[model samples]
Target: MQFSIATPTAAEFAALYLETGWGQWPLETFERALAGSWVVCVARDDDNRLVGLGRLIGDGALHAFVTEMIVSESARGAGIGAEIVRRLVGEAHRRGVRDVQLFAARGRAAFYERNGFARRPDDAPGMEWAGESRGTAVP
Candidate 1:
């Protein structure tokens, strides 16, 4: 697998995002979001097909968080996800971002831990603004 990570063009990013079930946003919305992100990393296979993606968003200094990490179902378990995280963290470091963070889904904490992320007891709770009901609510 000849893979590479780079900042994807807006169109390429939107295309891969749709492939990963983020089709709710219109193309224009995707373009806007892509332009606003501090950094976006895409993983491509030997054939140059996009197999994974991740993005970082925050002010240019002091804070940043990795988000939207997704790998094509067929590409899972092949270290593509790890590569994306590695690249994203590298980008943050290069930018001199002071606080890089990511929220792992349940049961996936070990994966991030392996990548050098530690649980933070001093961090405040995080929240999300869901635009639509997903049959759940915060306590």
Candidate 2:
């Protein structure tokens, strides 16, 4: 497999996301998310098919958030996801970022923990607010 900083097509990203059992999102939504993201990494097989993808979004200064991490079902056990995370985090470090954050899906916390992420402190709880015009974009 090969990994590189990439801007993947909406179809490739949508296929990978579907592998996670998440509902299909529109191509435009995927494109819009990539347009606003700070960093992106994609893994391709020997055949040059996209098998993994992840992104980082933040101000690129003190804080960065890891998001949209997904590895195709056929490629999950090969450490592609971990490599993606490692590269993303390493890029954050290179940018002088101080905090890297992510909201891991249920049952996937162990993966992030193994990558050096810890649960939020007792004083800090994860929260969200969908605005009145909640967009369809993944966040």
Best by TM-score: 2
Distance from true location, Cα of 95 in model 1, Å = 1.5
User: What lDDT does candidate 2 reach at residue 42?
Assistant: 94
Candidate 2 residue lDDT tens string, 1-108: 999988889888887778768678889988898899999999999999999998999997766788778888899899999899888877766676647788888898
* lDDT (C-alpha) at residue 138 in model 2: 24
RMSD of each: 9.9, 8.8
Clashing pairs in 2: none
| lDDT (C-alpha, whole model) for all candidates | 0.70, 0.79
The C-alpha TM-scores of every prediction are: 0.76, 0.85
Q: Supply the TM-score for candidate 1.
A: 0.76
RMSD of 1: 9.9
Q: Please provide, for model 1 over 93-125, each residue's C-alpha lDDT reduced to its tens digit, 9 standing for 90 to 100.
A: 667664677777768767777776766564554
